[model samples]
Target: MAEERTESKTTILIVDDSEINRDVLKEIFKDDYTILEADNGKAAIDMVVKSRAFLAAILLDINMPEMDGFAVLTEIGKVKLLDKIPVIMITSDTSAETERRCYEQGVADVICKPFEPLIVKQKVSRSIELILSKRHLEEQITSQTKLLRAQYQQLQKQQEILKKNNALIVEKICTIVEFRNLESGYHLRRIHDFVSILGRYIMNMYPEYGLTQYQVDVMADASAMHDIGKITVPDTILLKPGRLTRDEFEVMKSHTTRGCDIIRMLSDIQDKDYFEYSYDICRHHHEKYDGNGYPDGLKGEDISIAAQLTGLADVYDALISERVYKAAYSMDKAFGMIVNGECGVFNPKLINCFRQAKLEMNNAFLKTKMKEKEELKALHGEDDDYDDD
Candidate 1:
């Protein structure tokens, strides 16, 4: 059974012009591998081309009839078969020149004419082992590459789904503040737009601030949550038609610190940079640049740029929009109040950004108002258009 199995194994093609040399090589490998014989180089090439897939190696004589070993090497090199199957040269001339020429023709090993059976067997075994190992490694690399590609595609799909869910959560939170009636329906929307306008201007004019377009967008999104803590304030003070007493005003001011607390509770669900932006804007948007504002009297650049931008936007929106305690001011009056330090002292740099962004901020406010009117008309059949007071 063992002999039968070896006879059915992959072939070793032995090519030589002498019958005696071909018979010698065949006797050596006859037990371990199936042996195929060719008396001339042309016959060897034909056998190799027909049975290349099943051939393990080719042992060729340098001096042969019709087509020499060099000619056979040249023909096989065209097909790139040498990369997969090694060719060992057998020669009577063992000079340094002949050996160099044999290796240059892509020969794996050179052997003298009076062949040593042990060395021949060992060299053939080693060459076949090396080829098999290389083939296995190539197959593994191809398989791993395909698997990594599939995993990368799967990760991208997961990230997209996560992004949509986060947007929905933000909308729902903003809806809660709207339901409480602390601000007008368009108040948060206006703030988001104003912050975006100012943020872009500041980023362009002051490269030292290290603000990117992405950070600007994050600050704009976070501005909506600046007043989220007002939900904790009582409706009596929040909706009071008259100015609050000193004690009630203090309670109203606590909304900033309280808003930060609320955001901390939600830290686990928010992205790292977004959570930081939200937390800073919420707690410090009410802070004054002159160390006189509420909660934490943070002054100047000590107040984060995100907080500063949101604070300016919040004051502008409050001035132009009708609230329970105050009627809406004109656009010109709102811009003047902020820049002149009437609402509260602000950073000089930010005031410059605010001044430069005046026309854009006005347009944004009007655009939002128009959109709100259109939405109201769609929902309640009200077609009355309102102007900036």
Candidate 2:
């Protein structure tokens, strides 16, 4: 009984100027539908706009006073309710042109006046079904689009988490290598900053290096792994106070290849650019531009620019910093050695960039030198009278 009452209360609108015509249609539908009536086209348009949520269909009279059925349809078009509400033209005028005009104005069907109640009921029922189905599909598409956007955002967060974890692992590897070399840990920091500074300068002066700012930053972090092979050398050779014996030097050189092998052991080390940069730097930082270096002896442009950058950074730090066997060279002397090719052959363009940046590099290193002195003093249990570089 409740379901039947709900079906009977479904709304339908009847529009006509003549009282008798409106009454006749209302009589036909009042039993099955709740009928709302408007005496003129203007009033019908207002009713449709106000009650469109519950209004199922419109039965419109073509010939009316003031605003006519066509004018009412133009109003419906303005509200964009043509797809959501079905409109059926009900009129006495049966001329073909009159029917054609109704159809042109987006009427769903045109029925001559004195139309059978059965035909009117069936047409309105079918139109409402089609409009409801379309609205349901549109709702489903909107829901799915929102879900897809949420999933894409979640995926981006996961990728960011993975990148941060990779960076942490890179730092761990750098610390392990520094501990093995008995380095003050400042070596890693200086090399990272030096490589980053030089990389940015090179990118600007030589775009052919094909480096983005992001790549330069990543290379700076990866540079810490360049000397990772030193971990494999015997402590006696690594900490030797004098020049290595020829045989000891040969064994020490193997650190380059051994570092690369260590990196290869990480199963999760995919062929990403940072990992590739670390591998090349670990194996080839010793290679000279003239092909006179150890291990694979990569020469000229054959060497990756990443390896070349780390090599120069490593050598510059080595020359200007004190080692157990040698006093720190003065800044002027260190500069002279590189320019004179006393350190090893390098890419000429890189050398030119160094020339331009040498003053700034020296100033930056002065700060690092002071910090290193403090650390060294603490390690040696010495007084502040330690000589400044």
Candidate 3:
């Protein structure tokens, strides 16, 4: 249908030894198509394979020197191009075995010799039309493949931009959380480094989380904002050296809602999903197994998976790090308490993975702490900035 608009003409290849038959056939199709002639089977094969465009149907003659129609069909079968180009066997001897062999070798249609000029034209036209339709489908497939590839590349670049941009925002937010407690950047930095180590440990064990190197990089950068909710906690409660009183603790629990609100607002403006992702992790990371968490008491499986994972990192660091009121527990004691204290609280599957790869997790934890110390020293090399109250 589309061919009617352009210099769109199908090509008919006539393979015969006799020049008379070739000219006669050429004359038959001259008005409707652009005719191409091949005196031998090899030439027809070369023209079909090397040239770009569809060969409607090959009118292959049985009687020819060197390579006959059968040989050409066989050659085409050998190369697996029979599906693209339909072969119509033109033979004088309508032998049973020859016809069977052509069909066995995967031919489209077979025509007997002493050919009727009108019938020859009709058969060739029909076969060509079918073959050309198939070729058009292939062209469409190639076009779609190229389009999908381009879209995939563009999406990948945009995700990179989102990953880095979100990290900067999370860092800024976590600094706000850190200032609420100690006014130093240490708490945010330490938690992020600890979570990075935990993430790597989990990735090594369970790759189903899509925790590839690139993904972990994104997770680590985003991890800094895990406690961003603490920013909304009142200064009296946040800065209280003593344990939070009952009423003060209730107010403290509202920080998660306030954090979610702020991030949700930012997500609305950015038209992005990364902040929402961090939002879930930040808001629900405190949830326990039996629905004891404040803000939204989502228990166990009800909690976001990202938040559950962040909880592991946050609690692990809290147990190990030296605090103002309580001394840090030893790693062995801390691990035992984490595993036994809450049932169905920490993801059992995650706990199992951590238990199995305990040594690796320990090594990662130590390495992360060391790395953070080095980084902190490099950032502030004994600067004389001190809190003189």
Best by lDDT: 1
Cα lDDT of model 1 by residue, 117-223, tens digit: 99999988888887778888988998998999899989788766645655565677778887898354478889889999999999999999999998998898778
Whole-model lDDT, model 3: 0.70
Instruction: Give candidate 3 regions above 4 Å deviation.
Output: 1-9, 17-31, 34-57, 73-86, 93-96, 103-107, 114-119, 178-222, 269-271, 342-344, 375-389
Poorest lDDT segment (10 consecutive residues) of candidate 3? 2-11
Model 3 scores a TM of 0.78
Models 1 onward score TM values of 0.62, 0.62, 0.78
lDDT of each: 0.86, 0.83, 0.70
Q: Which candidate has the top score in TM-score?
A: 3
**Candidate 1 vs 3: which has more lDDT:** 1
* lDDT tens readout by residue for model 2, 1-389: 95445445778899989898888888888777888899998899888877887888898988899889899999998999888888988888889999899888898888787878788778878877887788899899999989998998897897577567657766787668657764636777788878888888899999988999988987887888787778888989988899999999999899899989987775375337667888888899999999999789889999988888888988998888888778888888988999899998999988988888887788778788677778777866775566644
Arranged by TM-score, best first: 3, 2, 1
Cα misplacement distance, residue 42 of candidate 2 (Å): 6.5
Give per-residue lDDT, candidate 1, residue 372.
76
Model 2: residues >4 Å from true position, as ranges? 1-160, 269-273, 374-389
